[model samples]
Target: MAQTTELTIGYFTVIFDEHTGWTGGLLVLNRGGRPVEFQCTLPVRPSRAHEILFGTTLRDHLIGEVIGPILIKKCRTPLSMVCCDQAESLSLSASGGVPVALVGEAAENDEGPITNDMLVGASRVKLAGATLHVPIEHTETVEGIAGRFVDLVDAVEPFERIREAIKEAQSQISRAS
Candidate 1:
């Protein structure tokens, strides 16, 4: 029998406000860049203790340890991979949940070959002028990410949907006040 692969990808990002604190959202997309599932967290205001205790690791702590896990836990669908806007989210791979990676905008004409892929670290996958930093253990994910975006436009397109949804939610919250 011929094998078939179905890719259910996810994009996760967190936005922070000085007054409202941090909010996170996760959007899962099918092979065609259509939304499958989405999960968003309530605005989380870390106490002063959290700021002082977490110290230098505060951003990583809130993202990877606090908010990211909450959103990922709410997802019922199993994700093939999650592309994140923050590199701190790469630590989500340690949760032993779905594979997670950070997608960054590549510099202009940055078409050089990906290096350090063979090493046990982040493997860079260039797609549509964006660089996806896949975790070392999930090196096999490169094939799926590449194949999925071949027919689709860009891998980072799902992030737009997630951010827009969050903005709409924020507007609704303010209106209720």
Candidate 2:
């Protein structure tokens, strides 16, 4: 499998505003970082009752359990792995039916040097100088897929494109309204 080349990666993120609620976007990119497909959801905001009910778990529930899976399901392209910027979105790995990685800043407060095992529970991986944490069971799969693209593209750069696309989508939505 390592000898096989080329893989598609799905970058997913959700943007929220008081008025817009939650807007989710998924950008599917080829090994070269060119977009193959893009999907975004209509904004969904929790009601005041829902906000209170969910409490501290609201964001995770909305972004991970709800928005994340919806975007993944709506994507047409088969993704080798899905990468998300928010840790809450990591929950997608549990039911996304594909490997999911949470990309973010490094944890600097660890008691000692960070080893793959320490991070592996979260299926953490380093690619293009970014740290990504995946589901423990999918660690090997995410790593293998990421390995193919590390040399061909900066794994973290496509995320910028995803963000830009999300902003563009938000503006379009606003204009439409």
Candidate 3:
């Protein structure tokens, strides 16, 4: 909801490019009313919480452009998911409790091991309403991982959370006014 009051939104997105490695990012939509934009680095991976966020500043190269795109391609297969959110601890059902690693789309069919470590990678990003919880996971094959990433795009929906948070933030801004 776009009101006079400003708001912010935290959204999770997965990107896939056959030519390059699959990458994901957390988006912060600043609706603060003032035109000032807010752009911050995502410190953690969404599916595999333990893994460090992609930290290279490649904003000037083709690979960098591939890393974050406005539109993402879709996939037809299922990818392993690790819920990463500082808001909640991850609890998987496998031994070692390591999150399930995701495979790429171009690889031969094989369901990777699911861990009790819970695919929950614990990284959080705050935006419009509430903090977006995300974890990161990667597979041996980039193709499989990219494919799984596509599945992620299809699954783990969070638009409603964003909308609610934006509304709440706007109300708070209005009150302040």
TM-score of each: 0.83, 0.82, 0.21
Give the alpha carbon lDDT tens digit for every residue of 1-177 in model 1. Answer: 122246777789888878778999998777666677888888899899989998888887888898999888888777788888776787888894678877765211123433343224777776545777787677677656656665556767677778789889888998999
Residue range with the least summed lDDT across 10 consecutive positions in model 3: 101-110
State, as a TM-score between 0 and 1, how close model 1 is to the true structure. 0.83
lDDT for residue 52 in candidate 3, whole number 0-100: 32
Per-residue lDDT over 1-177 for candidate 2, one digit per residue giving the tens place of the 0 to 100 score: 112224888888877778778888888877767778888888887889999999888887998888998898887777898887666676787797888887755322224544555444674677767878777788888788877775545666666676688788888877997
Top candidate (lDDT): 2
Estimate, for each residue in 18-95, the C-alpha lDDT of model 3 and write its tens digit. 332333443333322121222222222223322234323221121223322221112111212322221111222132
Total clashes for model 3: 35
| Candidate 2 segments exceeding 4 Å error | 1-6, 106-120
Q: On a 0 to 1 TM-score scale, where does candidate 3 land against the true structure?
A: 0.21
Every candidate's lDDT: 0.74, 0.75, 0.28
Candidate 3 local accuracy as lDDT?
Answer: 0.28
